[model samples]
Target: MNQPLTLEELKQVMAEADLLKTEADVEAALDKLAQEITARISESLPVVYGIMNGGLVMAGRLLTKLNFPLEQGYMHATRYRGETTGSTDLQWQAPPSVPMAGRTVLILDDIFDEGNTLAEVVKACHAQGAKEVLTAVLVNKVHDRKNTELKIDFIGMDVEDRYVFGCGMDYRGFWRNAAGIYAVKGL
Candidate 1:
């Protein structure tokens, strides 16, 4: 675990961060994502699971925009326990909260970085007997280092390859509540 940053240091980090997407921009993207998702699965009565910690904000915001009736749940699986970098293996702190067997499953995550965590979660959904599994992310970090073949079905936005935080993403487990998206300076 990393030493928690002092309040002053955390403020300095935010002061030095570059704002990539404003809060309005994120809200607009969520509106669009909700529309797209509804067009595809509004009638499927899908089981939506948010990958916790990171997906909490995204899921909460997106769910309000989606008018259709669907079951909501959460799972906690992470490669980065509270750091910037990720480990090779996934850690499942909590499994799916609802059964997806023979049902359509939709997984929501905050970011699709290297894709390993999202891919593994999708695989797990399938293994749990989901008739179909789809993945969505609030942000897709554009880079060539993606290690998995999984393609996100719905994406809110594409961000440059940088250490980004905000809109449910965190910088060393902080700033996940920042209304806008930001890239850490020099990261």
Candidate 2:
């Protein structure tokens, strides 16, 4: 395991980070996502699963704006486990909290980076008998390192390929609480 970053270092990390999207920007994006999602499945009574940790903030805020009745649950599958880079294997700390058999499933996450984690989650949902699975992300990192062909159904915004934190994304597992999206300096 890596040692924890010091408090001063954590502060410095944020201090030198570049603000990519403000809180207002994120909020507006959520509004747009909520509308798009509602237009597609508001009446389907979809089972919404927030991929834990990174999805926490985005799911919470987006859920409230959805304006539709749906079952909300969480799954804790991770490839990062707090590190910047992902491991080859996905660790399922927790499985789906609700059954998706014969139901429409919507997966919410913070970012669509390389697409491995989300792709695996979608497959799991299918194996559990979901009639259809859709994906939504707060940010889509622009790059060509995607490991899966899965496409995000809804995206709040596109960001440059950089190590990012905030709006539930973390830097060394810190700064997930930052209101705005930020890119780590020199990363």
Q: Give the TM-score of each candidate.
A: 0.94, 0.94
State the lDDT of candidate 1 residue by residue for 115-176, as single tens digits.
88888888888888999999889999999988667979999999999999999999987999
Each candidate: RMSD:
1.6, 1.6
lDDT of 1 at 171: 93
Global fold similarity of model 2 (TM-score)? 0.94
Candidates' lDDT values, in order?
0.92, 0.93
Candidate 2: misplaced stretches above 4 Å?
A: 80-89
lDDT of 1 at 19: 100
> What does candidate 2's lDDT look like per residue over 1-187, in tens digits?
7787999999999999999999999999999999999999999999999998999999999999999899999999978787868886778899999999999999999999889888888888898999999999999999999866798999999999999999999998799999999999998
